[model samples]
Target: MAKEKIVLAYSGGLDTSIILKWLKETYDAEIIAFTADIGQKDELDGLEAKALATGASKVYIDDLRDEFAKDFIYPMFQAGAQYEGQYLLGTSIARPLIAKRMVEIARAEGATAIAHGATGKGNDQVRFELAAAALAPEIAVIAPWRLPEFREEFPGRAEMIAFAEKHGIPVTASAAKPYSTDRNLLHISYESGVLEDPWFDASDAESKGMYLLSVDPEDAPDQAEMIELEFAQGDVVAINGKELSPLEVMEQLNELGGKHGIGRVDMVENRFVGMKSRGVYETPGGAILFAAHRKMESLTLDREVMNLRDSLITRYSTLVYNGFWFAPERLALQALVTESQRNVSGTVRLKLYKGNVIAAGVKSPVSLYNPEIATMEADPTQAYDQGDATGFIRLNALRLKVNSGVEQNQK
Candidate 1:
């Protein structure tokens, strides 16, 4: 009989590296290591050779930067999904796409089981398993972190290092950096380690090095930089008069935003698993995009429509943060979000200065803003009649007046 096959979400990191070897030894299965190339610059270097040397029977490295931006990142940005009012849902958004691809690879490779290196206690485990269960319910999920035998074998990073050395598995992880990080096209996040302490200041020397996507705000250039973003139905289509692909747009914005230190956030967020976790994130491009997108919508979207959509942002954000990317309610809400962006086509000029994305100007062809009626210069030809306000205010204040009369009578 053929050996059972397992598709492992391989990152060439310490945890996944050890999991790859451990899976091979424990299950005695054919391991196909899969790495999703979601724009983690040098992290993908030599991944194939490393996976092969670490005992993977086959290795698959996929370039998913464009798909990640267009399919996952852009839609979430369009919805203005910001978890806990700060997190751009960077790491949270990437997991579903990665898990979906993992399931696809498993089906294509005829693998009976899929594996991930997400810790048992973290959100990634929930995200990965929930996505897998939604996408491919028949496939078994092999979570090494949840396995007792695996935990016993490698209790800590030191033991994992020793095991890798004994098995000739080359790894680049070290005990020096106490935090764990996840990076993608959208953003870079730093968590765990010293970050577990909610009061730990991230500005200290030890934590400063963890930032890869943006510079320190204090260290940024003295001058502010102005840029224009063009949007088509809510998604950013161009930057500074240049039409670029989704990936290129993200890369360019990230470069510009990073130089100005425009997007750095540290907050203690309520996790989906019912715990409070502190995380530091650098989402330079996403921050720029969100600010620009909102500015454009302000010019084009109607007042009541924008208000209704804004009301749903928190719920939509919660759904995404909770790993409901494939859930029906999320899909339904996304439909409404997509409808809300129908006329959100415009250009927004912004000034980036020392961690602030300031909107300078915004305009749209289908804008509902009327300069004539809005002007305080008192135009005679303006259609908005000053006489209308007397009746409007009296009608609106009738209930208030009636309530006051009732209270006065009682007194």
Candidate 2:
């Protein structure tokens, strides 16, 4: 009889390596290791060999960079979904895409179950399982971290490391550096280990040369760099007059923003599992794009439309942060956000210097900012009649006068 097959999201890391070997032994099933490349860069090196050597019947490494940027990142950015008014949802935004790909691989391979390396304490576990449940309900999820038996055998990193050593599974984790990180096209996040302490100085991380995507802001070039971004319906279409695809745009901006030392954030955020966690993130490109996009919107979006969309930013950001990417409510919110961007087309000039994305100027053919109507020195156009202020002020003050009169009578 053919053995049941299980699809595992393998990252060639310590936890995943141990999980891969344990799954093969415990389930006695054919393990199909799958790795999704969503702009992890050199982290994909020798991943297939590592997975195969760790006892996998088959290995699939799929590149999902383009789809990740276009379908996932673009839509979220359109809604301006920044968690806690600071986090750009970089790590949060990438989870659903990764899980979606895992489900597809599981379906194509006819695997009855899917597994992930996300810990029970983190948000990724929720994201992976929820996405699987939404996409393919029949497929079973094997989360070793949540299982009592699995936790008993491996209580900490040392246990997992010893298991990997005994099982001939190569791992890079050791006692020296114990922090954890998650990376993608958008950004890289560092947490746990020494970073677990809320008082740890994130600025010191720069001196220690811990950042990967960017240099220290103090080390940035003395002269500011100037660039222009062209947008069409809230999506960046061109950078400095050159049209590029979404993936290319990300790559280019990452390079530029990195050189300028932009987009480093350190904060203590509330986790979905009802705990506070300290995380330090480097999201160079995403910062630049977000600032430019908001500047572009200022020139084109109607005041009311912009305000209505801004009011939902918190809700939209929370949905993504809590791993509800595939939820119906998020989709409905996306539809509304998309409609709000119908005329958000413009070019924004920016100055990049010392970790700052300074908006230099903005212009759009469909701009609502009418200079003729707003000018104080001109009367020839008569676009806005100065005489109208008398009636307008009186009408607006009527409610205030009525309220004051009532209060006075009561007194």
Candidate 3:
């Protein structure tokens, strides 16, 4: 009988490194290490070699940047999905795409089981497992961190390092940063370690060189930079007069937003697993796109239609944050969101200065804003009748008037 093949979501990091060796030893199976290249930059350096040296029978590093931006990020942005009204859903959005690819790889490689290094206490475990269950129910999920035996064997980071050394797995000093970060084309998230303290001054993260995407707002250039974004059906199509692909849009905007010190968020958010966590995220491109899309919608989307979609932001955001991207509710909600963006095509001019993305102007061919009737000085067309207000106000006040009369009669 052939040995069982287990596909592992390997990051080439300390945790995944140890897990790679442990899985091979514990299961006595052929380990196939897989890494998703979703714009983590140099983190992919020597990953294949590292995984192979760590006792993997085979290694696969796949690039999913364009698919990540177009399929995942753009759709979520169209729904105006912001977890807790602040997070751009950077890390939350990336997980589904990663997990989907992992499941696909598992099927292609004929692996019976898939494993991840996400801790039991974190949201990634839920995301990875849920996505796997939804996409491929037959595949088994092995979460070592959640297993009592695995936890007992390595209770702390020190134990993992010792195990790696004893097993001849390479360990680097830079793997242990003051805080942990998850980077992709959309953003870089900073959490854990010193960031666990909510009172910790995130502004001080600059001095420690903790941020990779943007500079400190105070150190940003003195002059503001003006940029224009073009949207087509709620997705950015052009930046500064250049038509680009979804991947290019993210790459260029990330550069522009980072140059101006935009998109830094620090907050305590409620994790899906019923716990509050402090996270700092740098989402330069995502921030710019979110603001520009809102401005574009203001010009073209109907008032009530926009309101209806706005009411679903919380639900939609929660769905994404809670690892329900493949759920039916999210799919149904996405259909409504896509329909709402039919007329949300426009261009928005913005001023970027010191971490602020200020909207300067917006215009669209399908704009509903009629300035003639809106002008306070005078309405030459007389589209809105001044006399209409009397009946409108009287009808609206009729209930109030009746309630007051009843109170007076009682008195």
Candidates' TM-scores? Answer: 0.96, 0.96, 0.97
Clashing pairs in 3: none
lDDT measured at residue 370 in model 3 versus the true structure, 0 to 100: 92
List lDDT for all candidates, in order: 0.91, 0.91, 0.92
C-alpha RMSD values across all candidates: 1.6, 1.6, 1.6
- Those runs of model 3 whose alpha carbons end farther than 4 Å from true positions after fitting are 173-176, 205-208, 403-411
* lDDT per residue (tens digit) for residues 238-302 in model 1: 98889988999999999999999888999999988888889999999999999998889888988
* Ten contiguous residues minimizing lDDT sum, candidate 3: 171-180
Error of 1 at 111 (Å): 0.8
lDDT, model 2, position 94: 87
Candidate number of the best lDDT: 3
lDDT of each residue in 381-403, candidate 2, tens digit only: 78788899999999999999999
**Which residue window of length 10 is worst by lDDT in model 1?**
203-212
